[model samples]
Target: MDMSTEDDEDEIESAEEEKEEEKESVEAESEVIDETIILADYMRRFETRRMQELAAKKEKAEEKKKQLRYLIGVEEKRKRDVSVETIITPEDELTVSDRVSTESLVHPCLREIDISESQLKILNPYTVYRVPDDPGLSPAFWLLRERPPIYGTDGVQKFYDMVKRAGIRSIASLKDLLITDQIDLRYYGLESQVMRAICEALMDNTYVRKVDLKDNKLSADACKHLNNLLLRNSMIINLSLSGCQIGASGAEKLYNAISTNATLKTLDLSNCNIGNEGFEYIASALSNNQGLESIDLSNNNLDESCAENLRNLLSYNETLTHLNLFWNSLYSAKTWKTLIKGFEKNETLRSLNLSWNGLGVECLPYLSQLLSRSRSIDKLDLSCNRFTEKDAIRIAKALSTNNTLQELYLGNNPVKAEGALALVHAITPHVSPDNVLHLLDLENVWANKDILHELEAIKMLKPEVKVKLRGILSNYQLVGPDIKKILLKRANYEAMAPKIKRRKRNFGHFVMSLSDKMISQEKFMALIKKFKLKLSKSLINEIMLAFEGPRGTVDQGQLKSFYVKEFSEATVN
Candidate 1:
């Protein structure tokens, strides 16, 4: 009985131990379940916060849409009532101060005289003068009121009737009358009468100091009448005869008037079709006249001989400061050199324009040398010339030393990469950090990519220089990828590769190949020619392939044949 009891106690202890292990496992599992539930709650809160943030973003986007709609509506309303005619006001309609009387006002103030006196009286003075209603007209209108009555087609009959009623004596009273300066008689086709009236008014009024007959078809006879009027008038300082059919005879007559007119300082004979003989006459007049300061002879047929004569006049004339000889066919290099020589001694002449003269590369050096000595010339134009890279380099070198030259024009020259690089180098060093060279034009240069790289380098080295690259570049194609890759490999292996290791590799392969079998010079040359390879420098590919271990069952003949085939295929493809 005692033995049976001991076995039973032992069995009970074993059962109790098994129960305790099972209980510990259950409690651990319950703790894990509770942790999972807490994690789930945290995830739900995070999702809720994200949804609220997304709702706020939606509301903000809707508000922005409303504001955009409001702005678009306002912009559409602004475009509805605009008129082109209200944008520009005629120059002659502008008025001076209100303190000046009509009689005291200058006669040149009458730009338009077509309106009738009754119509003029009906028109508001503020509208005619372009004056605000609150400010009224300027005191210049008082000056106009004190001046002689202005006659126009609108009120000429009434003006004549009033004159007769006032017992005015002769046509002299009508002669001194001030007409509108802005006359538009195209409606009546009475250009002839307008010219006559201008001549009459200029001759009658002594205070008329300037006249502008631009865009008017004044005949040669009218020009003669105007020349006579100029002879009588001494106060006129400016004359404009642009866009007129004034031939050589008319130009000669005008030149004669300029010779005697001491007060005339400015003259414009642009687009006058003045021939060579007319230029000769004008050149002669310029030689004798010292009072004229500026002359515009653009769009005339001044050939080489006429230009030579003008150059002679320029050499002697000290008073003439501004000259425009644009659009003339004086393109000879020898003639330009002569003209530049004439300018060397000319100190008073400051601005000169010889653009559109068909200059070329041969002309640049001479001009550059001349500019080096020219201290007075501040502005020079060599635009539209057929210049090359070499010519640009020469000019850049010249400009480096020339201090007086302020503005240069090379807009249409065919300056390529070489020229741009040279110019950037030349100008970048001498320029101050604060005051770099203001203008550089590389427009239409063909090889501009290399130039752009050099420019980027210059910016990295010196950031102050301002460079301009202009013109059409839609056709500036990029280099091919295969070519770029080959160039890059060549650059790295030949320029930056490890020299000692490359030499060892080359020497080791040469020794091993020679030791294995004698390689003929003919075979080597054949291999080079087959691969289209340059052998001046060793290639890593050649070395690696030559030193590679032999393959099983591959004979030397088979290897040679394989290499020959591979090289030939590479060359052909």
Candidate 2:
């Protein structure tokens, strides 16, 4: 009994010892796992810290680069509080207060001149609102919800039609259709039929500001329907019936609708095959017109008689700043002369685009006279005018005297160096560091090396003059790099031009000196080696006979006779 009891107790003791060993093993393994986790966390922290340090180092390097660029006078992209043109004018210079003022130029106290949108730049004034395709994710979630887009509905016409069909007549739906670039009802139905419906519906609209019916090609009779629409829609700002086959009678009806209407701002009656009668009607409308700012009468079959009528309209009438009479040249001297007189008297007009006009050099004096007057033309486009060098010179002389003119385009003309040099020499003195002519386009004009040099000299004198000297010209030659360079420094203009001539004149003088001192072979070979001169045996004999002129070989006349063919433009072919 004792032996059995001892055996059982030993077995129990052994089991307890095994359990203690297993517990120790588990505790040791737990310690190892904990150590591993702690080491992994430390490694992750070290990697994160290293990456952050590298990022900080890169940022500091970029900052240093910017500082270096600033020190080196390199232009860097940075936010400027004010425009570059606005500078600190001296206290004595200003007749007004020295302190910075918050007065806006476009305030109510100023006289409201009807400036066109092209001349008047709205810089950074427009906003872009992005509407998401998914209506639920849109910024204006409550205001807009996705519905099946209807077949042919502008905000005004189709929305009203749809709402009426749904048996819901709401006056508030028209307010959302206020601002739109175009109510495109083109190609859905015939323009005559569609415009009848649209114009009738527009009568009920409170403020349908602008309507575009471009390329509609509706008959002249359809314009009568718009008369009621124009009379009732007093809030209409712009009306376009471009490419609609509206004749004189239709134009007369259209003009009669908005003749007294003060709210109309722009009228576009372009490409309608409007003849001389239609032009007269439109001009008559402008005579009584008060609020029209811009009008397009392009591609009309109006001749110089129409221009005379236009001059009469411009003479008596006011409140027009933009008039596009494109695709028509002044056919007569009488017409352009009248137009020039009108331009002289007119003060409100700013931009005039007389493209494709054959206003020849004969018209330049009239244009010069117009520029000499108190005309405020900021943009004048005289492209395709075939302006000659004399015409360009006249224009340049006029441009120098004129202060209000900024952008002048004399492209596609045969204006050579004489004209270009005259323009540059005249306009350079006027262009200061502060006030400048915005642009002068001489593209496709006959600009040779002399013209280019004159322009470059002008740019060096006044960096603000943006002269466009591009386009491949006809039979124009460039001055070689070895030839006499341009006179850039006007401060030393008198001192330097003579110096360059003297330097070139020395080439002939040096050859004469060599000829005097040495034999013919040694002198010829030495001259040949130095100037890389190629003289024929016959040319040498000719030079021998011509060398001993009255003034010597270096003399301007004698130099061309002896060695060098030219020292000036007079000597060269």
Candidate 3:
């Protein structure tokens, strides 16, 4: 039994040992299963994280591509917005040192002005002055506070940016005036504040020499500010205030400023309605001021009352070269006589524009005498006057003696072919150095083919003189259609020369009996009545004009042709 008990205990212990090992193995298997589940979960999480990283990288690449496209589009847009207008002269293309070193005929005053970049920049109307809150600022700022803004206008917000680029730009140059970098503000609708701002900006500018502010209708205050600019600035050579509404008060201010200023060369106050007193003030200032070279007082309501002031100005102002008295009312002989006396005393006047002044035949003799005596006067504009053929003849006689008159403008006058012929003869059949009449403007003058032919012959002879007949109406074309039909009617005369011989010799005698080569219009009319020709007064006048000669006479050859055709047609019928 003891042996059996011990064996049972040993079996039990062995069994217990085997049970403990199985339990331990089961726990180890459970731990392995848990660790495998955790490893699978971690592998799945790692795969998901790799996918998320790839997605993020693709998104980042797309954003970078979109940003690059946006940048390229912005670069293309900038290239289209900036376009510049460039006006380059030969002188402007040269370097400043090269320009200054040349021996050209540039004036000393013009040489003092600065050279530009040789381009025409558009005037920006939006870049306006800022109305500062402080009242103690400059006058330009003070004026801006009182003035109205360019309100309700589009693109007002872009002005500040444009103001930054407004500096260091260029403008067009006046080639004839030898003026470069012109700041043209004509019809810009600039108000007082705007004018003050522009003036302030231009005050320190040394590049611009011409400031054309025509037709702005600026007030007297604006003119005062401009006068202030003139007072301080000396680089400006030409100041055109034409068509401005500045009245007598404004004129007085400018005249007072001009009296003190000496650097300004050309002052244009035309169409300003400067009254008699205003005229006297400016004329008095110009009489003493020596720097002003040209003044245009056209359409200024100047009448006979201002003639004395003009006389004094012409007499005393020695530096004044060009005086434009166009479209005024200095019509009477007395007013012109005073002006003629002034011309007689003045020796410095080079150009005189008296167009549209209603100067009649009475003024022609005095003008003729002035042309005969004045050695300094080279250009004389007498267009739109009452100068007839007789007045033209008298002027032609004076022109033969005058050697200094280079340009004679007799446009819009009634100077006919006879007068034109007389003027051409006064010049010469050939080019002569003594007769320096280079330009003879006879626009709107009616001339027949004979006169045109003679003038062409003279042109071939005297090539130096340019006889301007632009817009010259043909005298033959001026006849009515009915008169043209009557004159152009073809008689059925088959045997032309033989029929004239059979009819005589009587037509030849009649043509000779009237006159040798030409007959007067009255004599032609008398002959038409004597021949019992059925003709109207209009026809008679047209016939005379069509067959007129250089001496205001009808051609006898045309008369003989007409009578022979008439008589031959009568016999044939």
Model 2 residue 347 CA deviation (Å) reads 1.6
Q: Compute the lDDT for candidate 3.
A: 0.72
Steric clash pairs (candidate 3): none
In angstroms, give how far residue 212 of model 3 lies from its true place. Answer: 1.1
Model 1, runs deviating above 4 Å: 1-193, 204-210, 429-437, 441-467, 471-573
Number of backbone collisions per candidate: 33, 0, 0
Error of 1 at 359 (Å): 0.6
**What would the TM-scores of all predictions be?**
0.47, 0.51, 0.51
Among all windows of 10 consecutive residues in model 1, the one with the lowest summed lDDT is 503-512
* Cα lDDT listed for each candidate: 0.61, 0.64, 0.72
Tens digits of lDDT, candidate 1, 1-573: 999999999999999999999999999999999999999999999999999999999998767645543432322112324477655335533532233444224322322222222222322333333443655456667766675566543333343445465554324333334343332222232254445555655554545555666766566677777778667766677888776758788777766677676777888888888878888877888888878899999888876777577777888777888888777776777777778767776888867777777777656767877766777766677667677788888877777776665566666677666676676666654442322345555555544454665566657766754666563234367766553235324533443344555432222122224333334444544544454333443453443244344431213343344434434443232
Ranking by lDDT: 3, 2, 1
Q: Sort every candidate by TM-score, greatest first.
A: 3, 2, 1
TM-score of 3: 0.51
